[model samples]
Target: MRVSAKSDYALRALIEMAGRTDGHPVSAEELGRQQNIPHGFLQSILADLRRASVVVSQRGQSGGWRMARPASDVSVADVIRAVDGPLVSVYGVRPEAVEYNDSAEVLQHVWIAARRSLRDVFENVSIQQLADGKLPAAVTSRTADEDAWQPH
Candidate 1:
């Protein structure tokens, strides 16, 4: 599963806002500068987040974007879905939505497993964990897997 640049920027933007939740609203310009996201691109991404109810925007003097809910309640999955759709997908279809025949039937299990694996990581983690520089034990263990990067 690959996170797109848009999703990366959205995560970063969310992190920035998470850190400053009670401080003040953060402008897209500031978020872009801080996260190095393209300003125009950030606007569109922010708009998506806004529509998803993940982030709320304020207009005028002390205005910008802030998390609609507490950062602790937001998951990485939420941000990813808001910006990039599903956490895991195969051939543009959800794992549960696809059917297979004969030998290809095994691929359904593979897709379900892949989606399950991704959810294991993405769902257990909340935005506040990232914002606070902490990750869940399950999440960390997956990262620490000695085989995480080596070819089988």
Candidate 2:
């Protein structure tokens, strides 16, 4: 599956926020500068995150943005969904929602299984884990295979 730049930037911004020791809201400018995300694109990402309740915005001198809940409660999947949409889609429709002819009926299962595999990693990984630079054993184990690092 292809990961969008929006999802990558959103996760990077959230990880930065999660890593902050101070309980201060991070300004968009600061987040953009730190994460190397374009300001305009980041603004739209932040807006989407805010609308999804993944992040909240504050207004004023001491105001900025903060997670709506603990970073541990927000998964990479959640961040991606907030900024993008469903994890897997066929022509904008969900894998299961897509109809197929007899010859292609089995292809739907491929999409569904692919989505499940993605969730196995994305859903299990939280922003806090990323911020702390510690991935779950389940994830690490997958990377242990030598072929995992090799390009397909």
Candidate 3:
């Protein structure tokens, strides 16, 4: 599965926000600067997050953006979906929605299984966990294998 820069930037921005303890909204400019995300692209990403209820925006002198709910409640999968739609899609449709000929019918199962595998990691990880620099054992265990670090 390919992870887009948008998703990466969104996650980084959220992690920065999750780490804040001042109880004040973070300005987009600050988030962009800190995360090294392009301001224009980050704006669109923030807008998407707001529309998904993953975040809320405030206006005024001391206003900016903040998570709509607890960081622990927002999963990586949730953020990905908020900005990029479904976790996995083939030809712009869901894996299960695709119809294949007899010879290729089994391919649908591959796509579905891939989606499940992605969910196993993405769905289980939360922004709070990332902010705290601690990943779940289920996730960290997978990285214990030295081969996991080797490129194919």
- Backbone N/Cα/C clashes per model: 0, 0, 0
Supply the TM-score for candidate 3: 0.98
RMSD of each: 1.5, 0.6, 0.6
Q: How well is each residue in 21-68 modelled by candidate 1, as lDDT tens digits? A: 466889999999999999999999999999999999999999988989
Model 2 per-residue lDDT tens digits across residues 29-148: 999999999999999999999999999999999999999999999999999999999999999999999999999999999999999999999999999999999999999999999999
User: Candidate 1 — which residues are off by over 4 angstroms?
Assistant: 149-152
Positional deviation of residue 36's Cα in model 2 after best superposition, in angstroms:
0.6
Candidate 1, after superposition: displacement of residue 22 in Å? 4.3
Model 3 clashing residue pairs (backbone)? none
lDDT of each: 0.89, 0.97, 0.96
lDDT for model 3 comes to 0.96
Q: What shift in Å separates residue 122 of candidate 1 from its native position after superposition?
A: 0.4
Please report how far candidate 2 places residue 132 from its true position, in Å: 0.4
Model 2 C-alpha RMSD vs. true structure (Å) is 0.6
